[model samples]
Target chain A: MKDVYKSSMLYDFYGELLTEHQKEIYEDFILNDYSLGEIAQERGISRQGVHDMVKRCDRILNGYEEKLHLVERFSKTKEDVRRICQLADSDINQKNISEIKMIAQEILDNY
Target chain B: MKDVYKSSMLYDFYGELLTEHQKEIYEDFILNDYSLGEIAQERGISRQGVHDMVKRCDRILNGYEEKLHLVERFSKTKEDVRRICQLADSDINQKNISEIKMIAQEILDNY
Candidate 1:
């Protein structure tokens, strides 16, 4: 289940690299919570075939993550942005906000 | 010279995925400006072999960029960050600074 969430996030970052067919299968499986049997029926393939495709999609996404780390950095950036917001609400210096924003902008712009 | 710089920058982002042999040959040729003959002699390969490896490395790096757009985003983020810095320098709402910082942090964190 947790893997599903991770895979979904990884998909968001690297989904463009996958085939359209793989994208549909992965979306239905991970995001829509469809069973492999259901996905197989929908795609007109064997259940085992569906399983294999989903696993292959996972490997492709994971491989990209291992090398590029777009998903990992994206999660960290979210946390850092949250912290910056919290700090902003407090008595932190406004000038610090400027510097922090530059760093944050750089990260958001890329991923 | 332009191609060399671009390759060097691409290498900064995706060089790790290359084999050690590719890495050494690429660095010597691109980064160190070694002549093909020099690198060929150094690596005990023919000049043609060195030429082929460098072209292969370019294709490999270019392929990753086309799929991922990491390098493209990275270049844009730098530009955006510069803009954020400029905005910070100019007179602006302090609270807006906070909100903008959050976005910037998110971008920077990922790429």
Candidate 2:
């Protein structure tokens, strides 16, 4: 995924946990496509301060993702569901049903 | 589920993100079944302090679950997978396959 897109997705998932100040700066810089100098001027902080805050936000968001893995599991579950759909579209067979059950069990086991 | 079991599940999922002090105190009080006074004396803190800390930890962990819904989704997904397994165990037919596919699609849509 693109850097900004990934950041935004992380932000969407975990942004509420961030402080109000961090949220404002992160939105302006990453989501709104504002320049460092522009956000710095608006927030009455130095450009380096704004830059540091954005980097800190990224680290914090990534840290949450690493620990929680909610996003990762979601992607994997979606893929598994898609695979099940494909299996279902094929000819109905006992083996096919077994495979579907196996996939579902895998999904359950993962949690 | 039992209170301790539920707390342990939350701790297992999100406890590592907590401070070391929080983890130790929580493990003692919740997992080891230590009383507030016992924990407080062990840590050289007041019973009220230990009680406050445990309550705070509960709030924090519950807050994380509220926002992220990882635990909630895990339970729901497990139930869905069990439903899929049951559907699979029935007679193999077009209706059964369609139901399986529909369940899979529901899982995908949820994510």
In Å, residue B76's CA in model 1 sits off its true spot by 2.4
Please give the interface root mean square deviation for model 1, in Å.
Answer: 5.0
lDDT of 2 by residue, A36-97 (tens): 99999998999999999999999999999898776777778878879988998898988888
Report the error of model 2 at residue A50, Å: 6.2
- The most accurate candidate by lDDT is 2
Candidate 1, lDDT over the whole model: 0.75
Residue A26 of model 1: what lDDT? 92
TM-score of each: 0.75, 0.74
**After superposition, which runs of candidate 2 have C-alpha atoms over 4 Å from their true positions?**
A1-5, A20-53, B28-51
Which CAPRI quality tier does the interface of model 1 achieve? acceptable
DockQ of 1: 0.25
